[model samples]
Target: MEAPQQTEKKRIKVGIPRALHFYRYFPFWKKLLEELDAEIVISPLTNKKIVEVGVTHGFGELCIPVKIYYGQLLRLVKDHPDLDFIFVPRYVSEVKDSYFCPKFLSLPDVIKILPGIPKILNFEVNVKEFPISTAAVELGKQLGKGQNKALNAYKEAQKYFDEYHAFLREGASVNQALRLVQIIRPFTLPKKKSEGDIRFLLLGHGYNIFDTFINLDFQKKLKDQGVNHITIENLPESIFKTPVIVNPRGAKLQNYWRHEEEIMQAIRYFLTKGRDEIDGVIFLISFACGPDSLIAELIMRDMKVVGLPFLEIIMDEHSGEAGLLTRVESFVEMIRRKKKGLTVGRRNKLTIKSA
Candidate 1:
């Protein structure tokens, strides 16, 4: 479902695709634009129709997240054409521990393939020893906010951003961000009420977790089960600091392959840190992701012998709701039974029951 409108304001409405780096930078975006005195309108979470629309417009081989974004772009144009401008930030390379996989870098370029994308307020950032504030100034210039207004906005935005992240760094969850804003958050992290605090590791590209539909109410199920799972977005970029080493030649995400490598390293970290605490691993991958295919194979092989109870689900625009729910149910039951020390049974099979 779409989020309820906040207020009728004359401020510019910026459409943000709830994908890719949305989670990592939303607080920043929120702070920046609020400083710019513009209103933020986030695209609704990914869903079946949205996914299909994306596939219809996107390159055949792109991952599901990109397609979901395309669909969202179309919907925004059709539904809110009156908006001032839609944002499509241009980011290339690893900005600290946060890395934009190749596809993310290619997003603005791909917009030409789809019709009706509004004027994009871009803040393109590539490695060149330039300060992010300069880019923000350029963006301000484009928005017709006099250089001074833009400068002030950028300064205030940066300050708010530091404060926002400081709260999170202090162990505040997403809910805390909303609380600070005095807005009711749309989602919640699963509480620790679940017995024995059964834990599982969530593996997926950052885009998927933040998008609600593409993952098929996955969060609700976890919340319902009181399951505590750790998503990529849940971890701060600083976590990937000097402690977590990437590939020697460079685990640079030239493509999805490198993205998978980064995830693998994270898996190794989680496994080593909470081996006894984590009950199993649930990996979420787009239907056509190449890097994920290889990573899935590796995860299965590594977990199979050790009986780690692995579950992998594919998210395509066409993936059904019922099937997705069933798959999760099976995974949960499998873990529950194992916790009871029951007799061994065939498990680890993909349990998506499509309608």
Candidate 2:
């Protein structure tokens, strides 16, 4: 008998935008898709053209990060026209009583308005209602995977995800960790902080903090200046998970927003236990972000009480590199002066009482 011709299995190609949650949960997504024999296509890094496209197309009231997300999705649609599906999970709530920002909840539906976009492979991720594995299994089923296969993929993805976070806790930048875990190709490694004289606690959502293009390469500039900084991601999970007392009235504020809660907890931890470790704080928040506005006021008040230097940089599409550089350079110099007991006089208008 003639040998039967072998049928080649068609690989599903899924596009993932390199924005927002990609900074946080990419490794898990990458692993899951790979296990299901899907070819993953990530949009290029943020650039001027991408920003312009996003701003032109995105809703007026949406924050810059969400706008950038729109840009990334459009890039995938325009550049990879043959993509089978675009993965845009609805991240409603990760923990009980705490939820993602409103934009995230509506992301999938909002992005569908863009013309010529590929089919969106979406699933709800509300840990309060069901485990992520349940969602992952359903996602796999959509890709024609068996329940056992999907569950196995989830287990593998979880393992890789934990390892990725472990790398972060060990002082790797998100890019570095992603590269180490083989999700992304190698790039120029970040400068080591071994000899830096000052340390700042950099606070922001991962999307804002890690996307160098949008943030105008803020972290790189700090590193180049030999100024060390730590982000909320670098700290151990236990520290940020601890509940925080946001005000002196002992009225424990339960922040319902997930990222804001982490930021608040991190600020509290630094204020109480890690006070000496950091010289100052640089909070990068998006313009017109409701949660950020509320949290920013509380952070400023808390930092003022502790007499720790704090600088809040508000970002939007119009944020210029020159202005950001000026502010960052001035903040670093001020911190250095404060640390050295050099007089930062009234002329400079730095109102934060020296620690």
Candidate 3:
């Protein structure tokens, strides 16, 4: 009689929603899932149908990014019906006194109860409170994986994440880091500048500014107008930790949201230390963001005092591409005129105060 043959281990299909944190932390998650020998299925990019499904399923008052997230989740379920788990990291506090948005903290809970959704494998990302390997260990246990194997996977994931950010700090856009690596060569700080080229600092969350469909190809629009831009992600981590951008009253503006703090700090830097380098600033904010509402107000006030040419584009499900293109064209023209010492009357001005 022949000896019994051993059964092959089945690969678990892990679905990752391609919105929100996906844009911020895709490399980390992708590496981790790959290390676990799981088949990863990332949700498709944001599109019209996905936005409609998200708007229909999500609450009307929720922020646009959260609504888009819901749509991505729905799409993941529909596209990968056989996925064994959906990875949703429960982001709490990454730094002292700073918190993730309340919606992000509650996302997994909301999706868990939704009908037809796959099993949610969530782990706490509050680095101050838990070990970084906590998520890997817990998820490994659920998958019947050994703790040592999970810990090793976490280490490798972290290594890749650090390298990814290093590329970003070296002046590569998120899209470049994600898609183009053959020509990528990391070098020392102070990446070469584009002398005499029009530059502007585009400020917003990754999901808002980088999502092509949601932001309506914002980067391309700027590039088409003979402009170059940098975002919060392009700057070094040390910039955010600086003690500048202080409130007028000598009290720090206590922004507890991590992303919000970075945005505000970047604004403060550009307004003070970086004022001469960039032509102007464009702020893209999503509607119904509690944190952004307060931060934008503060930024707008400061920008006016310095008389920086500022434009805040408020985006939502109802945002129109034609209108956005027109606004951008006008703003770029104003900056060009200002650069060329040509007068731009107040009538053609783009003001964040009224936005």
Best by lDDT: 2
Candidate 3 — which residues are off by over 4 angstroms?
1-7, 180-196, 243-253, 344-355
Instruction: Order the candidates by TM-score, highest first.
Output: 2, 3, 1
| Pairs with steric clashes in candidate 2 | none
Q: Among all windows of ten consecutive residues in candidate 1, which has the lowest summed lDDT?
A: 184-193
Q: Rank the candidates by lDDT, best first.
A: 2, 3, 1
Note the Cα lDDT for every prediction shown. 0.69, 0.87, 0.82
lDDT string, candidate 2, 1-355, tens digits? 2344346666899999999999988888998889888999899889999989999998788999999998999998899999999999999998888899989999989888898988889767999999988998899988999999999999998887887777788787876776555545433446763779988899998899989888988899999878988888889989966665565477766888999999998888888888888999999998888998899998999899888999999999899989999999999988887777786475587667888
- For every model shown, the clashing-pair count is 1, 0, 0
- The RMSD of every model to the true structure, in order and in angstroms, is 7.8, 5.1, 5.9
Per-residue accuracy of model 1 over 1-355 as CA lDDT, tens digit each = 2344555336778777766667557767776776777777776666667778888888777887888778888877777878778888878643543445677777887786678778788877664557677777888877667777877887887776676666554444543454454352433333434353567777877566546677766766776776777654445555454333333476743322435656776566555554665788888888777768777887787677566888998887777888988888888877987788776445455677999
- Supply the global lDDT for candidate 3: 0.82
TM-score computed on alpha carbons, candidate 1: 0.76
Which prediction has more favorable lDDT, 1 or 3? 3
Q: Write candidate 3's Cα lDDT for 155-200 as tens digits.
A: 9989988988887887888877765422334433445555436888
Best-fitting candidate, scored by TM-score? 2
Q: Tell me model 2's lDDT, rounded to 2 decimals.
A: 0.87
